[model samples]
Target: MSVPHAKLPAWAEYGLIPLVNLAVAFLISGLVVLIVGESPLEAAYHMINGAFGRGEYIGFTLYYTTTFIFTGLAVAVAFHCGLFNIGGEGQAYIGGIGVALACLSFDRVLPWYLLFPIAVIGAAFFGALWAMIPGWLQAKRGSHIVITTIMFNFIAASLMNYLLNRVFKPLGSMSLETRTFETGGQLPKLDWLMSIFGLSVGNAPFNISFLLALLAAFGVWVLIWRTKLGYEMRTMGHSPAAARYAGIKEAKIIVITMMISGALAGMMALNPIMGEQFRMQLDFVQGAGFVGIAVALIGRSHPAGIIPAALLFGMLYQGGAEISFEMPSISRDMIVIIQGLVILFAGALEHMFRPAITRIIFGLSPKGRQAAATKGA
Candidate 1:
């Protein structure tokens, strides 16, 4: 009486749909380029060349790349344990405040040797506390962390406003900014380090934090893939009840994962404050938490995959600035458009590839079963 629906093609499950999504994005980017009165190929070519071709652009790209690595990894870590940590912004703000406070306190007392590490650790600890508060609420009180973290972001912003406005402002300066310490506290120029490697660049903040980021990425990879803790975390992520039956302690794992995620979020601040700017400003996290979701999605929640995804984001960021310069009329919104498209495609890629993936994993499809039945005849 009724026709049966055909199963989705195995190719569709393998991410063929994502390719279609990408084609759609390219057409849209092309349209945008044309609307801006530039050749699509030319604009795209220049964008690619600028982002990856030039040494200066390369430096800028890496600068952002370093920050995004932490944010993306932060998001990915929580995702690994089936926890959603949307509080990365708040955690980063708290870390920023800690680093700011530390810089103001010990900048004069301690030599640069001790000051830098202390500030970084202080920042990370503060971030962990901020993140853990929400995590605790979720674990202990059944509070929705997503909602709480969003609220915390606002609270942290208000707290920053208070600090900038009254508490930390230098008297008679008529500015919220603290006095930049002239000696001993400044981050050692990575450019000098770069000179040892034959890289010459100025006004950019390349620092030891760059190496720290790579090491952190590797560390996250090892933690997620190579440890029993990682196995328990994954099991809990897939099914908390199942994990419980398998002897995985959900609460302990949840708290630990949340703390680690928060710390990773805190590490994001180092790239901006300690690495380049060397001074604190309010609102420095700059939506990195939200951007991190896209980064994680594109990375498929893999730490190693985060590198390329972060690089893609960093390139778009640099390209947006350059495009803004070349075509003042064109809004930086193009970057937003492209990023949205990438997230959309990457998210759908699994669905696109799902059938083949499932069949490969399971060794048969519905059609495969039917064909085998016919072959037996």
Candidate 2:
């Protein structure tokens, strides 16, 4: 039997704790900057300016944010079902195949408005299918999801490499990518959205897919909080034995949850495929799938939390580039260290301050007071 833990107030759990962790991360990062003989304040100023300085900068930041949102939500959904899915990279890779096929088939005959829905379906289907096999093995064959998912990512990369080189590459092109899509296959930029803020999108690739990512986040919120299946998922996540006793089908839920997670990951391909690249390219995921893990961790596996968490990473990525450019002494490796520190505090060390926080808040309730006393003893 497990001892019940004291719960923090919603404000502290959701807001204060995360803020504390972020502050610590920045402090450590500042120390590193100082050790390297640069002013942390100046580096921070440049980072902020780089990520949000111009209309184009903001657009690029949001573009990266859009990809992170889909992948972050993917990880979050599986987390709610008590599963860790590390195969978002592979799922997104396979999903590119679906997007490419759809665009190649209809680019000449159909307008983007008509093709977009088909591409969405194709991306979702392929992504879900790729994820289902691992879920099935975990459910029926006792395979570990983390191990299997990791293996699948390697498999996916190999499969895509073969397909691109032998199958999809156009004749005599001497390139690993397919033919670029025509106008009908390309998604329109969300210049109107930028204009509303009196900003121009400029050459940034922010597009309709950003809006789609926001809608998907809203849909995930409804699914996790409003639907009956979501209740079962949460219950299972809390305790598999209890969920089983309550008549929730564990096997079915696992498969479905994995599929949903994969579909969201697969949709990540849409941002690069239609919104920016306008064609499938090698390794276009650019490690966003792995970044999703950190995003979900920082977000606490909630859609509402996931959005801002995604934006934070977006800022890190865009700003890291600026730091490298403006402060050559800082170096790209130094920027990576800053990001790694944030992930370390926000993810691996998330609970480092929890005990102290609980002690501070534990006196408000008789139960909490008793628990604190019991812990002290």
TM-score of each: 0.84, 0.93
Worst 10 residues of 1 by lDDT: 1-10
Cα deviation of 56 in candidate 1 (Å)? 2.2
- Which regions of candidate 2 fall more than 4 Å away from where they truly are? 1-5, 331-336, 361-377
- Per-residue CA lDDT of model 2 for 1-377, tens digit only, reads 45444567699999989888888988998999899899999999988999999999898899989999999999999999989999999999898988999999999999999999899988989999999999999999989999999999999999999999999999997878989999888999999999999999999899999999999999999999999999999999999999999999999999999999999999999999999999999898988888888789889989889999999888888887788899988875664675577679878888889888887788666887886676755
Worst ten-residue run, lDDT, model 2?
1-10
What are the per-residue Cα lDDT tens digits for candidate 1 across 219-244? Answer: 98999889999888888888888999
Candidate 1 colliding pairs: 12-352, 13-352, 13-353, 13-354, 13-355, 14-352, 14-353, 15-352, 15-353
Q: Give the TM-score of candidate 1.
A: 0.84
